[model samples]
Target: MVIPIFLPHLGCRDRCTYCHQGYITDVSGEDIKARIDAAFIHRAAPCDVGLFGGNIFGIEPAVLEKMFSFFEPYRDWVRAFRLSTKPVPLRDETIYLLKENKTDIIELGIPTFNDAILAGLNRAHTGQDLFDAYHRLQEEGFSVALQFMVGLPGENENDIENIIRNMVRLKPVYIRIYPLVVLKDTPLYTLYRTGQFRPTAFDDVLDCACRIYANAVKNGISVANVGLTDNELVRDMVAGGHYHPAYGFLVQSRIFIRAVEIVLKHLGYPKDITIILHNADIPLLIGHKKQNIMKFSRMGVTVKWVPSGNNRGHFEVRSQKGSAAGSVQDIYDQ
Candidate 1:
């Protein structure tokens, strides 16, 4: 479990077009210690304490020292510490400081690989900067996690594809996929008002996110998150774009349905089949409203889901007539 501390927009010199961090974050500067103390008091030892939301590394040196000092009391009990930062140059001293504080993970926001898109969003960093920071973090033995947002201004299918391919090559231990949301008072909202830009259609972004998620899974990279955290603040501020409360679950259900269809195709339209899946995948396979199962029923397919404790990805498709064949990985391999 993670105990997250939000810094909001703290080290971001320039705001991205879609960002409204001030509205999204719940914790403020005045209550940072109170929130931290409350979270730490309830959390048990050996859990991750994450510094989320802003560019932590970009914080002033004195303030960074103060923040680290705050965590000093919990150092003996905290299993690992993680922080999110922008994809910018890092000093050797920063690495030393993080290492000294026992920070195990560093997450970088690399939204997209296209330099043009990056500039349009005013991210103030380039793809090369991301690569440099990633390698430097790894060289210091820090586990890296990458964060990407889909449906950004001036992005296309090819742009997203390039990002996934490049990210796979980077091979970060974890990744996050956030679909673009046009928040109130952001530059992107102005663009929407002026008819200069439009957010990607919900279906299109969903399709793109599924592809990214599937590729990450196949490459052995864990997708830590697939959507923004839903809250009243976000709901009130949302101007437009893909903003589902259960967005990640929707994508997972889509992937599950696709996997089932692929297995059915391979089985030559078997009348009765038992799907052996991991115990944890029940919610995804069953879907938000049992949509996946309902889809199969509509297709005139008889489906039975059997839970398996050890199955992770190589699921067994067992025919009622005593034939078992095809795994989830087989669909991708073909």
Candidate 2:
């Protein structure tokens, strides 16, 4: 379980082209303490406490220290202390302070590595800032996650490939991908209005995101997230772009389709085939609205998806003439 503590725009120095944090309701420090207290007092299981909504390090050291102190009494019950921040200069002392407070992971919102794209987004940090912060945090023995976005303004397929290559080189403990969404009162929205920037088509974005997800997972890096969260504020502010509550499912469904296609291609489109997958992946395999099943049907290929209580990613395909069992990598490699 994870308990999120939203410090909405609490330490923002500048706004990004997609953020509208000012419209979000604020949660006071007192309110945070009360929530934490209630979580521990009422809940029995261990839970991670996340400090989200803005850069935690950007807050004043004194106030941060005070906030960290609030978790001291419940330290034993806290499974993890995770926080997200922008790619900014981080002092060594601040790293040490986080360690002293038992912080577990630091997620950096790096978005994209392309300098031109970063500039277009008005992300006030250089690519070097990301490398510096990543190295510094790792050197301090803290797990770090590099957060990336899929459809930032000016980003393309080549940009996505480059970002994946760079992220693999960094080898962060976790990676998150947020497909861009044009929100109200942001620079991106202005650009959209002027026809200066166009959001990537949702299907195109889903395909691109699936490529990144497959490559990243194959590299042994955890793709912690695939899309943005849906909420009242997001719904109210979203003007366009890939904003879907079930975005992760959509990406996985695409992946499932690809994996199945690869297998079928290799097997010479047998008359009938049974694809055995883990039970948990049933919905993804069938796809949203049974799209995959229907697609196979339209191709005149008899496809059956069977669930087995086995390891995820481990699957088997059986046809009248042949049978094979392998993981996604096996099929993808073909």
Candidate 3:
């Protein structure tokens, strides 16, 4: 488990076009100490601590040192430290401080490798910066995770390919995929209001996210998360872009549906079939709102599912004519 301490926009020099951390997180930078204290109160087990919601590397070494000092008293309860930030301004001093403070993982937010898009988002860093930071962090014996965004302004299929290529090459410890969401009062919101930045089709964005996620899993990289966590504040602030409360579920269900479609095709589109899968994956197979079931109905295939002790992601489809067993991994392998 990880205890999150949100320092929203604390170390950021300038807000990105889509950032409005105040709406995404309730805790302010000023509440760091109090938040930390509250989180550790009545703690019964050591847990990892996550410093989130700011460009941690952008903070001065002195400020970072002091900020880490807040956790000194509860250091015994912290198994390790992790933080997320933009992958630039990674000063050697900051690196040393992070290592000295027992920070084991650094999650770099690389929205896209497209230079033009990066500049348009006011990220103030390029793809080269991420490569530099990633290499440096790895050399320092730090495990790295990546956070990627989809459906950004100016993003296209090429950009998505770039993301997959880099992710496969770097092979981070894990990854989180987020579809961009325009928040209220942000620069991106202004663009949306003026009709200058219309988001891509929702299904298109979801499909692209599935491709990224599938690539990550196929490459043996764990997907730490997919999509943003829904909250009242975020729900209230969303102006446009791909935002959904069950966004992650939608991605997983899409992958399941795709895998089933491939298996059915290989079986010559059997009219009726029963899928035996691990009980844990029933939700994924059924999908949100039973959409997958309805989709199968439209395709002239009758679907039935049975729970089994079969390993997760493993499914067997049976029909009168034939039987085939496959896993989600089959989707990427083909």
Candidate 4:
């Protein structure tokens, strides 16, 4: 069973320019309890429950006390509890309080650690604030996950590398990479409208993701999420900036591209080959916007994704009769 708890914009003191979540959730205590109870009946996730959204750290202590009370019934079944909050949420007293609550993990959205960029985004806390929170949380014995964004207005490309370097220095157990996604109805949208903000380009996003991917691989920190969860499929979405729901799969495919380079060396590479993956993973394997499949075709590789074996995450590629012959087993072996 996988149960994801989204409180969505509950306790934020500073409503970020891009935030619409303030209109999207139940901020009241009774609503929180009701939502949790309703979720239990249909939830399929294991005991792990994720707490996300609405300034989780900005709220009062009593809110959390009651919030935890709602979880007491599931404590035995719940193996872990995780939550995501702004990077500024990390305070010494907050650290002590979270420890007392037995939170297994705290995901801090550091967005970008660049001081100037932080101000540009109106991110209330500083890069120093993030590190302060991180160190305090570590000392108190909690697993930390840092979430970062790339390509904010006024930030240079080098800032991406710096963010990665800082995270490596921090040595968190988990991380999430979100290229700057421009959402509407927020202050960012206004900035975008006024030409005050410019999103990172797609090519740059791919390039940055590649660099971050390599460093994450070397660092051994699990990249839990690599992109946006909701793509532009929603009708009401305001704007687009490297927004793709299947961003993780694209990053994985990019990783596979690296692997393909190695595999082609041994198996006379074909100009085109059809890659078959399980049907269940069509969204992830094909990519959020069919970008992966299309991109491969444009690169002169005939990649075709077909439904196959029940293995959820497994994939196999076949070359057309006249195209070439590379062992599917060989690719899988790699």
Candidate 5:
């Protein structure tokens, strides 16, 4: 469940180049304080209260302390409290504050790890800032998450690799990848208007998503999210940046296809192929929208995503060349 609160959405000491404050935080004055004090503390909502919107701890330190104090009593009642903040908020003191408040999880909107891209995006911090914050939070025993964005202006495959490299160094408990998304009334929109910015292509972003997810899995890291949340209003408001309501699903489906491609290259199938996948990821490998299935069919691969009781997110691809199908033997040979 999502529990919303009003604060600086980006929550930096100052707004960055692509900040849209109003759209993110629609609360004002007493309403904001009241919600933080009441809804998350006194009032009964969902068990999970997300101290969300912008930077959760980005207010004045005093205000931050007050907000923390307000929720102290109810900390145990709630199963978990997720604090969303800027990467800099992972400083020594900030981690202590979160711990004191009994925060169960912490997430940073890192955006990108490439220093040049981050500077161009006006992220107000460097890749080191993320690493420092990440390490500090970990030493303090907090569940840490690092968020990265792809397909921003000045970002290419190298920039993407940089993100992966830096993030792997951090080894965050949760990793979220957001494709660059443009919104109205932001610096990015202005750049787009002047033709200085071009949104990443949908297919390109999908390919990147597959690599990123695969890398996380290879490293035994949990990819908490792959793309922006699916919402029609958000999609409609997206003026630029690899924005698609179905993009996340497509990315997941592509991951399955990528893995299947690897399997096929090894197995050498020349006919219709049936791929059975682990139950947990069946929806993703086949796609929630049957996107992967269609893509597979178009490529002359017939994938039948079935439950694999013995495995999760693992699949077997069967190449049907009638009775003469020789690919099955390749699986045994491997």
Candidate 6:
């Protein structure tokens, strides 16, 4: 298990268009050390620690060292450290400090590859900055993960394609996809209030996210997460954008339905079929509120599912006419 210690805008130089981490995180700066101590105290065993919220790379090297010092007392119980930050202003001194510490993974937030979108978000960094930081981290033997956002102002399908292409090319250890949510008091929220920025339709944003996620899986890059964690603060602060409690599940269900559709097409649109999959994936196969089953019914196909001990992401569709076996990866391959 990994313990998350939220810094909550601790090192951020400037806020992104949609970022209001103070509300999302609800973590106070004064309680950081206390939070660390409390987390380690309840640990049953050594665990990985995640330093989340805020731009860690933007901090000065000296202050960064002082920040790392807080965890020194719990070094024995700490397995490794993972931190998230923007890609720019990644100084060599910061890289050396991360290496000296037990920080093994660095998650860079690269919202988009389009320079115009980056400027619109006020990220103060370019796509090239992400590439440079990624290579530098790789040279220092650090595992890299990427964080991407969808549904930003002025984003388009081509931008989503760009994300997929770059993700496949860079091949980070894992990735997280977040649909943009305009929070109260942020610039994005102001635009939403003034009707200056209008988010794309919810389904359209979800489809865009699914394309990114599917491409990542097909390329053998792990997708560690798909949406922001749901909480009361998030629910209250959400002013616009694609914020759903079951956003991740929705993406998985869409991918699963796509895979089933591919298999059915290969089977000549069978009238009846039994889907054999790992027990854990039943929810995805059934989908939220049985939507997948309803979709099959609407397509003039009868579907039944049986749990199997087969590995997750593995499924077989058998019909009277024929049978086809495949996974989500097959969807992209075809």
Q: Largest lDDT belongs to which candidate? A: 3
- Model 2 clash pairs are none
User: Which stretches of model 1 miss by more than 4 angstroms?
Assistant: 23-31, 42-46, 270-273, 308-310, 318-324, 331-334
- Residues 1-334 of candidate 1 have per-residue lDDT tens digits of 7778877877666778888888434334446666667777865667888898777777766666667777666776678789999976477667888888888999999899999999998989999999999998998899999999888877887887887888889999999999999888999899988889888789888878888888888888899989989999999999888899999999887877787777777667678878888888777777878888887788887778788864665466678455454444443321
- Tens-digit lDDT string for candidate 3 (1-334): 9999888887788779999988434334447778889989989999999999999998878888888888988989999999999997989999999999899999999999999999999999999999999999999999999999999988988999999999999999999999999999999999999999999999999988998988888899999999888899999999889999999999999999899888899999999999999998999998999999999999999988899999988899999769999788777431
Tell me the tens digit of each residue's lDDT in model 5 across 150-232: 77777788777776776666677878887777878788889988998877677787677667766776666788877767766
lDDT by residue for model 2 over 27-65, one digit each (tens)? Answer: 567866776677678766778888888877677677678
Better of 2 and 6 by lDDT: 6
Candidate 4 lDDT at 232 equals: 42
- Please give the distance, in angstroms, between residue 51's alpha carbon in candidate 3 and its true position after superposition: 0.2
Candidate 5: which stretches are off by over 4 Å? 1-6, 21-29, 37-46, 72-76, 89-93, 279-282, 302-310, 320-334
Candidate 4 lDDT at 134 equals 82
| lDDT tens digits by residue: candidate 4, 178-287 | 77767778888888888877776876676677667657756767788787676344325748677766566676665555444444444466676665666775665455
Off by over 4 Å in 4: 22-26, 42-46, 89-93, 231-235, 258-334
lDDT of 1: 0.80
Worst 10 residues of 6 by lDDT: 23-32
> How well does candidate 3 score on lDDT at residue 185?
94
| RMSD after CA superposition, every candidate | 3.0, 2.5, 2.0, 5.5, 4.6, 2.1
lDDT of each: 0.80, 0.80, 0.91, 0.69, 0.67, 0.89
Error of 6 at 108 (Å): 0.4
Q: Ranking under lDDT, best-scoring first? A: 3, 6, 1, 2, 4, 5
